[model samples]
Target: GQVEGGRKISSNTEASGRFHTDWLNMIYPRLKLARNLLHSDGVILVSCDDGEVANLRAILNDIFGEENFVAQFVWKARQFTDARANTNISTDHEYIVAYARDDGFSLKGVGRDESKFGNPDGDPRGDWMSRSMLGLATRDQRPNLHYDVVDPLTGRVFPPNASTGWRYSKDKMAELISEGKVLFPRNDDGRPREKKFRSEMRSEFIAFRSIIDGVHTADGTQEIRSLFGVDLFAFPKPTALIASLIEQVAADGDIVLDFFAGSGTTGHALLKQNAAENLKRRYVLVQLPEPLDPSNREQKVASDFCDKLGKPRTIAELTKERLRRSAARIDEENPLFKGDFGFRVFKLASSNIRAWEPVAADLESSLLKNAEHLVQGRKEQDVLYELLLKLGLDLCVPIETKSIAGKSVNSIGGGALIVCLADGLSKDVVERLASGIVTWRTALAPAVDTRVVFKDSGFADDVAKTNMAAILSQNGITDVRSL
Candidate 1:
């Protein structure tokens, strides 16, 4: 969507107070949160065009300090000429503004060309490259580097140029000559070069270019057409662009998170990249289930597609379906591959625990409704995941269950979160359940202390709840809670 009020030059707003406020107000908080979420070495890239590139740079300069500014990469998104141009002009490029979290951050640059350095002279140190020894300094800046350089073998003096002085001082130049690191020319007026050994180089990679090309938006359209046999998204990013970014920053086992996962291109990119490189990388994509409207020109086909599939008319449903097809395509292509191709969907909703809402007029009915702490018709797995969230466990954490004393118990993240949300908890089974949990906790031996939770209303009586807590506490599992 376009900016609500366009870019306002003035900071002050009109009486109605809507002067280019919608876009800025929406992006400012999200950028702040993204900065807070980034690790010290992590980078945040925001894609924009001529509309808000200046405003984005200004705000980013304020959030991530100017020193942390990485690069403003230009992606050539369009390959073909614009034939339907009203103004006889075409904008075929977009800016990806990147900023690092700290000054220490740097990209994993492109691979180095080792072929450029070879031991042709047989100096015995290693492969070396001849580099110019001229320095970008005037005689006034460094008086020591302006002196004449003598070729010890030729017995000839070579005066350093006033504009481009010698890179090293007189003492360093003499040391290099003694160490045979300075290369001399056979001609009379030729300046010397430095022998830079490959072993002494600090980095193996050279700097990456700021301009990106070859990958185009047309590739993304073709991908959608191949996967779904229809162009569902009007403007989807090509996987090649995202795959390039991933290769520059991410490594094996790294998590690639996309907050606005339109059409789930990032996931598709990471999956194909991992399969091609034989790596273990994962992705987390977050997209809203906003209902698509058939009236909209761009979303009409997508909404109709969802109708044909008997799914909800939402962008998120299409994203899920795309991922499903993407995973199946990978499996079909790579039959021998044995990596994770799992995709799971989760939505934001009310908690499974029923909060007590008391009505002053109907106290008796409130008590009856509040008798059960857990909500009615909630699945056991749903309640267990709720406990996992409350206990600060990963949503994708491993969950294992066991039948303890004829009751269902779940252990999450090994034993970081142990929960028993089962029904029919009585005094007779309290000791047996506690002992089973203790045994499991001992065997798992999680890094952190164990947190056990139970269904508060599942106890037959008050004495049974007390006994359950007491047995667990005696066994050293003190941190316990209930739904």
Candidate 2:
């Protein structure tokens, strides 16, 4: 659903717009809500094309704070040849904005692929990769970094280049020599230069730049065609492209969500990443169940293909099918990845219970029209999920729902939280709730804090609130709030 307080004003022919201040107003609340959903050490990755990149970045900087910005990744989606000849500029890349929930969030360093590291010499120190040791400093700029390199085998001193100096001082070279980190490269004339083994390198590597150009749009298109045996979608991102970002930013067992789950590409990428690295990362994908235009030729082709394959015709159906196939592929490739994909389905709908209608006909109609504002098209469970997002609680956290006094009460994290969404709470119910608090106090483990959240409309009167408060005070339950 479109978030409130934002106007969809058209600006360009392609349905783009210059968002008004209300757009920022709309985004702020969602960003704030999203921030509350993240773990203290979690991060959020937001993707945007050129249309809203600047505005999104500015909004994020304001909401998440400038210091929390991790990086803006630029993914080149198309080839240079795809550039428009008239403009002489290729608009092929999209930006993914990243921000940490807090200063504590950080990426685990990228590990070197074992296949990429190899040692030709077969030294006992294990596989190695050669890297340049050249320094940018000139002799004039850094005399301390300039020195002669002695060929350990030939005893010939190689002077520094006139323009550039050595990377280390004489004393540092001596220390490296003593530690056996430097290798003397042999030449035809029996002279040698220094070689550093990969074993001496740090276990983790630093994060790379944000620009990515290896995966092309053709790669993405080809991947979809090969996996599904048809080109059903346009401009799908390559699984590798998304995997690279996930691997760089997310950790094992982390939750990665993509609200604009176009073609289920993100889910495919997450599955592939987990299979390749033996990680246990989870994913949440959301997409509008936009209906396909059956009259269109391309849509007809897609429909026919799905019919032939005994699949459903809607976009959501196709999206789920893609995920199913991706999961199957992972399972086929590695049994360890089997049964690793599952999702809880939730669809937005009007609340199951109706609110009280006013006695007057016109007033009742108005109330019904504005019902969406007072009551959401969501259930208590849905509200709880949103609250969890707002509170930064993990989706996997255990939630127990019990029917206490004919009310569906939810307790999360082993009584750490008690939520009552029941409407029309009476004094008798409030007294029972107070008694329930005492029972919960005894049942809850020692030193574990408990909190209760109630709907403001639930209580019948102030006397009920007073009674509840007095009971909670007696039971040492201070954390309570009314929504």
Candidate 3:
């Protein structure tokens, strides 16, 4: 893959309409997959400039439906200046099109401004803020809630105003007064206010705003400069920008995914947020190995950085390095943070197990030569990861390796899946492996069914293989198979 470098986008018919359609064509399938990955309440935010904002919105609406479309946040990504010199209008803002998987999607609100809250009365309930208890509706609309207030200390009764009504019913108001939640006015005629304790308040969240400002492109550049001591990326996303979006939907220990992880900014932001909040959140980043051209001014810095680190001059390499640097910095900055900042690297490619579709003429020869279905030059670990894919397990799930009966066995997802790629399994080894699996299974206690897999050819004979499966089955491990 090669970087388009903004050359593919233009106002012309060839680039504007056709190019955007092409972009949507590429994104349509990915959007369907992303929807499947999302939780019922999960949200997905896609950032794009003005070029394809309308098209992006249309595609999202078609995929997620109009009802699931949340909001289009206008982010001030840059200062009030035109990106291109010829354009008179300043296209300084970008749009983040958000969509939810279902109606359960709810964004966590920003905490209330604590500065506005205080304990003026020194109430035992701690800090609180006073608010008028008057209802917004007219007295005619809510006749039942239009009752008057009575001040016990003042021994005076105050009637509701002709326009507005009391917020609570007479019985509820009496209960509030009994609980000291209603504030009595010093003057007999003064209006009684309600005491809203910070500890007891339910609606403390400030509503999310559709406009995001303050963070700009310059800030993003400065962030990279601070981290790498040089501008490695010309337009890295601001950590705060992505972190804010993540906080709105993602909770502690949730996984955040970024398929086009340019410079790994999304991963860096997730790590920073986890460190700041003392939470453990994981990230999955995918980037193409789009080579950096030395002739391009924007990519020269990245190219030099690659040369300095003795790594490949590609966007993928830079992305990984950025994550490593960001994690190291976070650990150094916050030594007390115990969250995991490590990420597993996975490359998308064809499976390690060979697929056979031999012709009738060559079928016999193919079977004789390729008795072992496993592909050549593939490592045991490679085969293990391929099994994880075939079994539809998350790649990021923890994988533990142990020596069971002198054979290396991999325990994945906390013993939910036990895979042994060892060769020449004997009766004693089978019994030992089964015992170890049962012990680990009991200790780990995976919520799902535990499964065991072995290389079909690795066994000494059919008897050993059958014996292993039978031993595991006798120990209540029914799900067992071979590669």
Candidate 4:
């Protein structure tokens, strides 16, 4: 049932065997792209039920490597009593498999459990908690750490045992004692403890455990129901569960991505989390525009929603609608906690530029006619984005349009790069534009690798084209080119 709506094709492969191969074929390229998209210090958490956990792990291991496997968090997806009708056992849990880009990764802990931390002694350093100073290393393993320490306050000596040695060396112990960071008990028989101050703690990170419970499927279902007045999605993940995973690995203002964004749950959770933490975390969600089959009972409500909203009957349309309603609801409920709950939507499409392909019979005629390169009817924004891809620049960079010499120019990354594809470029306009961009470069970015690009065939004549290049080169901005 889970794989019912999958794309079908006639093949010699067995039905069950085809499923695995097809699924992996779809996922493999996406995984490769996701890895490239992530920052080097970033981590990814993927949720899956028991149905494909084994296969998923093997694929992850092959892609991210076995060493980069961070943890497998087992979440209670459903209650024990939520049994499947045909199966003898109920599937009550799911896995959140995590992997880092490399060995360099650490999760920020769930903020210190304040219930266990307090200034019991009222030490000026701050609220402190005590931990055992003894480590599991034996005296033979670390003889330097097998030392005795005298508590300055209690005048009591603590010695390392045969099985466990003192955690710190004599010099380190003395340093801790001088800083009043070591807790000395009144009873001389007690072992000396290390005081970890809330302020001085190097990192507020705890190793995320492998098992996560209590976040149930009911919460996720309730979330969708609350927004849409009905359960439009099947087995949507809990917002809290996703938020917790995100908070562990991501920092404020980091980009969160979800490719399988059913019902836009990830976006909803990000908005709620950002509102709570006063963060500017952004999200990138990708959901296929799968057409809803009204014949299927599960998607009937969603299909009806599409009709009600007067939108196309597609999953992506519903996903976007959910995000819109969720953001509006959050704003209404928490007016004071204002943060960006908005997203700019972009659809994937073929390049706006026509690829140069010579016709065998009329190669010369075709080449001359399509010299402009860009396809007809392509919007300015489309051309800009295509150029961004060609230049290896981030498509989402802040773009600002400025009128230079009466022609519109697009400045990206705060004047780090400027593009002018307007037609009919004259020598006078070219000179004025070059001077204006130089001024902008000095004021905005200043020696920050400014580059200027133009339409190759748009120049009025050879004199204008040569003048444009000479003017830019004279102004200490030689990185000029034309498409």
On residues 124-231, what C-alpha lDDT tens digit does candidate 4 reach at each position? 877888888987788788889888888776566777877888888889989999988887777766778888877777766666777888888889999889888988
Query: Which TM-score value belongs to model 2?
Result: 0.66
| Ranked candidates, highest TM-score first | 3, 1, 4, 2
Candidate of highest lDDT: 1
TM-score of each: 0.77, 0.66, 0.78, 0.75
Question: Candidate 3: misplaced stretches above 4 Å?
Answer: 1-17, 80-84, 121-202, 403-406, 414-416, 424-450, 463-479
Residues 2-120, candidate 2: write the lDDT tens digits: 52344222213343353445455555676777888788888888877887788899889887899999888898877766544677766888888899989866666656556656778
| Candidate 1, poorest ten consecutive residues by summed lDDT | 1-10
Mark the regions of model 2 whose C-alpha exceeds 4 Å error after superposition. 1-30, 113-130, 178-180, 188-194, 197-199, 294-314, 353-483
RMSD of 4: 6.5
- In candidate 3, which residue pairs clash? none
For model 3, the run of ten residues with the poorest summed lDDT = 6-15
Error of 1 at 291 (Å): 2.4
* Overall lDDT per candidate, in order of appearance: 0.86, 0.74, 0.85, 0.83
Q: In candidate 3, residue 28 scores what lDDT?
A: 83
Q: Give the Å error, residue 363, model 3.
A: 3.6
Q: Superposing every Cα of model 1 onto the true structure, what RMSD results?
A: 5.6
Clashes of 4: 0
- Tell me the tens digit of each residue's lDDT in model 1 across 256-351: 788789999999988888887788888889886767889999889999999999999999999999898998998789877777888767777788
